[model samples]
Target: MDEFNGTEINFHCMYIPFCDARDCDRELYDSPVDCPDCNRGMVALHFTILILMAIFITMGNLGIILVIKRNKIFHNSFNMFKCSLAFADLLVGVLVVPSGAYETASIMMRSFDPTALNRTDYLIGKDVAMIRPDSMCDRIYQEDIGGPGMFLSMISVLSVMASIFHLVLLSIDRFLAVWCPIKYNQRKALKDKCAISMIIFVWLVSITLSVVIPMSLGQRHFIHGLSPAMIFTLKTSNPSTGIFYATFGLGLPYLALLGLNTATGSIILIKHRNLVRRSSLSPSLNSGGRRKDEVKATITILVMIVVFTLSTLPAMVAVTFYNGTEHKKKGDATIRSIIYSTLILLLVSNSAWNFIIYSWRNDNFRKALKNLFTRKQQRQRAIIRWKQLKCSVLLLSEEKRRRKKLIKLTEASNSYSSEKM
Candidate 1:
C-alpha cells in the first residue's frame, strides 16, 4: 500500500504451499495467477462469504421489518428510519450479493495467458496508469449483459446510497429531537408523515446523486467489483475524476456524518451531565430516568449510523485506490480477487448484521424477534402435526373399508356354494 503509487513494478504472485484435494491438485505448470486451484478456491471462499452475507441480510432485515410491523414499541419516527435502513439493506441482499458472487467467480476464473505489462502499451520507465478503464479491462463483471446489467448496476448504486443517506437522516432526526425538544414534540403528530416523506426524499436524493448524476455526468472510477453496489462511477484514463468522486462523493459525506454525530452526542452528554449535577435527587428518578432513556436511545442509534457508515469506508478506499493498469487488470487477478472480495464483503456486512445490533441494543426488538420466530416455529409445528393426524385418520378409514369388503366377499362366496350344493 505504501508503494501503491510508486513506479516500482512487482512481479510477485500470491500462491499456496500446495493445492488441496478439494481442487484436485492439478494446477498447470504456470504462474500462481494461472493456477486453477487458486481460482477455484478463491471462488468457493468468496462465493460462500457473499451468499452467507446475502442470506443474513435478507433474513435479518426481513426480521427487522416484521418486528417493527408487529411490535408497537418500534412504531415511531425513529424506528421508521431504522426500517428505511433495513429496506435499503434488503435491496443490497436481493440485488448486490448475487452480483458479487458472480463477479468474484468470473474474476477468479479469468486469467491472461501473457501478462499485459509488456511494452506494447508503452508503460516503460514512466509510471503505470493509475486509473483502470472499462474499455481496457475485460467486462467480466456485469457489464456485458447490456440492459439488465445496467439496470441492476443502477439499483445497486441506489441501494448503498440509500443506506448511507438514511443514516444521515437518522443523525438529523437525532439532532432535531435532542437539540429542539419543544419543536420536536409540537410536531409529533406530523412526525410519522414527515418521517415517511423524509424516507422517500432520502431515496430520491440517493438515486439522483448516485444514479442520475453519474449517468448524466460520468465520473471515472477504478474498480467496484459489482458488490454492495456502493459505487457506480465509470472509468477512464483520467485520474482526476476518480479523485474527485472519492473526495466529494464519499469523503465529504463521511466527514459530515461524523460532524453531525459528534455535535449531537456532545450536546446530549453535556445537557445530561448538567441536569444530573443540578438535580436534588439521583438521575435514576422518574424524570431523570426518562431523560436517560431518551439519551441512551439517541446514542444507540447514532452508534449504529456511525458503525454502518464506517464499515463501508475501507471498501470505498480500497476500490477507489485500485489501479486500472493492464498489469493490474491481468497480473493482479489473484491479488484483486482477495482484496476486492473482502472489501465487497465489508460493504454488505453492516446491512446484513444490523439485526444483531438491534437485538443487542434494544430489549423490545430482541423480545419481538424472539417472539416472532418462536411463534412462527410453533405454528409450523402445529400445522405439521395436524397434517399427520389427518393422514392417520384417513388411513384408519381406509382400513375399515377394506375389512368390510373382505367380509362381504366371503358371505357372497358361501351363499353361492350353498346354492350350488
Candidate 2:
C-alpha cells in the first residue's frame, strides 16, 4: 500500500510543470516571460467582451438618465431612485469596465517571465505562479496615476452597491404607495426632500464600504500586488472579512430586497383579486384603466426584482465561497477564472440592461422616452418652417418694390408721349 501511494504521488508530481516547492515562492521568480498562445487568446476574448459590455452599459444608462432629466413626468420620488441607479450604472460602464479591459489587454500583450504569481494564484497556493515575470506587474503598478486603478476599483464597488440600495428604496416606495395609499399620498408632499436625503444616504454608505474601508484595510492588496479582477475580490483575502462582507454587504441587502419585493407582490395580487371580485359584482363600476395600470406597475417591479436577483446572486455566492475552495489544479484554476468572469459579466449586464426592462414593462417610461424624441423632431420641423416663412416674406416684399417701380416708369412714359403729341 505504501509503495502504491508513493507511485501515485510521483505520477502527480511528474505532470506538474514546476513541482518543486521552492519554485513557487514569490521572491524567487520575479522575472518577466511570454504568455502561452492560449492565454493570449483568452485575454483578447475577454477584452472584446468587456469592451462591448461597456458600450452597451454606457448607452443604456445614458438613455435612462437623459429621459428622466428631460421629462418632468419622471421627476417623482420613484423615478429619482431610478435615476440614481442609472447614474451609478453609467459610472460602472465608463470607469470600471474600460479600466478592467485595458488592464487585461495590457497584461496579455506584454512579455513577462513565467515565474511570478499574481494575487489570485498567491491566494490559492504559493505553488501556483503565473508563467510570467513580475516586471509586467511592476510596470503596471508604476503606470498608475495617483492610484487610478484603486479609484476605479472603489468606484465600481460603490456604484454597484448604490444601485442595489436604490432598488431597495424603489421597492419600499412602491410598497408604500400600494399598501397604504392614504399615508403614501400624505408623504408625497415631502417626496422631493426625502428622495434627495435617501440618495445621499445611499452614496454615503456606498463610499464607506467601497472606499473608506478598503483604503483603511490597506490598498496594497488591490492596487499594487493584485490583478484587476482580484481587486474586486479583495474581501476573500481574509476569511473573516469575506464573511463580514458577505453577511452585511451583500447577503443582508439581498434578503431585504427579496422580502420587500415578495411582500409588495403579495399585496398587489390581493388588491388585484379584490378589485376583480368587485368588478364582477358591480359591472357598472368599471375601473379597467386604473386596474390595468396597477397590474402593469406590479409586473414591472417583479421583473426588475427577478433580474436583479438572477444577476447578483451568483456573484454573492462566489465571493462567499471563494476562500474555502481549493484551486490547486490547473483545471480547477481555469474553471474558477471562468466562473468569476461570468459572474462579473452578469452583474454588469444587470446594470446595462435595466433600460430595456423599463422600456418594455412600464408604459409611462416608454411614453416619456418617446415624447422626448418626438419633441426634438417637432422642434426641428418648427425651425425649418419658420425659416421658410421668413424667406417667403422677403421675396414678397422684393416683388412689391419691383411692381411699383415698373408702374412709375410706365406713368412717366405715358406723360412723355402725351406731351410729345
Candidate 3:
C-alpha cells in the first residue's frame, strides 16, 4: 500500500496528479484517486459551470443596477439594499468567478501537459532523476498573495464577505419595514445617507476582517517563527479564536439574517392573511392589487433568505469544522477540499441567481425593467424623429429663401432691360 504523505496529498490537482507513471514513477500512479478521465471531465464541468455563472452574475447584477438606476420607483431603502447587494455580487462575478475559471483551466492544461507543471522549479527539482516530488509540490500552496491568483482570492473573499454583510443589512431593512412601518418610513426618508454609510461600513469591515486582520496575523505568525506545532496550537487549535472568528464572521450574521427574515416573513404573512380576510368579508375593498403586490414582495424576500442560507451553510460548516479540528487525516482533507469547492460554487450561484429571483417574484420590478428598456427604445425613436423633423424644417426654409432670391434676380433683370430700352 502506498503511504500518502502530507505533501503528496496537498499537491495542486489532487484529483489528477501532474506526474504520471511515465513522467515520474510507479508511486505517483499508485495513489488512490479519481481516474484521470473522470477528473478531466470534472475539471471541464467546473470550468463550464463557473463561466456560465460569471456570465449570468454579470448580466443579472448589471441589469438590476440599470433597472434601479433608470426607474425612480425602485429608489427606496429596500431597493438601495438590493442595489448594494447586486454591486457586491457583480464584483464576485467580474473578479472572483473568472479567476476561478482561469485556475481551473490552468489545472486542466497542466493535467494534459504535465511538462508545464514541471517547468516550474517548485514542481521539479534540479535533477530530474532525483526529483524531490514531496518538497516540489508542497512549496506551492494556495492563497498566498505573492501573485495575481492570491490577489483575486483576496478580492473574492472581500466581496463575498461584503455581500453577506449586505444581505444581513437587507434582512434588517425588511424586518423594520414589515414590523414597524411608520418608523421604517422615517428611516426610509433618510435612506440615502444611511445606505451609503452602511455600504462604506460593510466594505471597511470586510477588508479589515478578510485582508488586514489575516495579513497581520500571518505576519505575526511568521515573525515569531513558531514551530508548526506551536502555530497550530496557538492559532488553528485555539478554540477561542476559532469560535470568535466563526461566530462573528459567518455564524452570527447568518443567524441574525435567519431570525430577522423569519420575523419579517411572519409579520408579512399575518398581515396578508388579515388583508385577505377583510377583502373576502367586503368584496368592495380596493386593496386586492395592493395585497398581491405585498405578497410578491414578501415572497421575494423569503426566497432570497432561503437561497442565502442554503448556499452559505455548507461552506460555513466546512470552515467551522476545519477551524475546530486539531488534526485531519489525508482522506478528511481531500473530502473537505472537495466539499469546500462545491460549496463555494454554490455561494457564487447564490449571488448570481438573486436577480432571477427578483425578476420572477416581483411583478413591479419586472415591469419596471421592461419599461426601462421600452423607454430607452422610445427615447431613441423620439430623438430620431426630432432630428428628421428639424431637417425637414430647415429644408423648407432654405427652399423659401431660394425662391425669394430667384424672384429678386428676375425682377432686377427686367428692370435693367426696360431701362436699356
TM-score to true structure, per model: 0.67, 0.70, 0.66
Question: Tens-digit lDDT track for model 2 on 1-421?
Answer: 0111111100001111111121233453332223231443444566677788889889888889888897777777878889999999898788877876665455434544454333322211223322222344334433332377667767867877887788788877877777776556566643789889989998898889888888887633333222324223333455666567767777887788888878877887887788688765753334455556556766677788788879877865764444312455666555665666577678768777689999898777788778667978579768999999999999999999999999999999999999999
State the lDDT at 405 in candidate 3. 100
Best-fitting candidate, scored by TM-score: 2
Ten contiguous residues minimizing lDDT sum, candidate 2: 6-15
Of the pair 2 and 3, which is ahead by lDDT?
2
Candidate 2 ranges with C-alpha deviation above 4 Å: 1-34, 39-42, 111-146, 182-190, 219-233, 276-287, 323-332, 370-421
lDDT of 2 at 249: 76
Model 1 misplacement above 4 A: 1-39, 103-145, 182-190, 218-248, 279-284, 324-333, 376-421
Q: Count the backbone clashes (under 3 Å) in each candidate.
A: 1, 11, 0
lDDT scores in order: 0.60, 0.63, 0.59
lDDT of each residue in 245-291, candidate 3, tens digit only = 67787788778887887887788789867867886576435555544
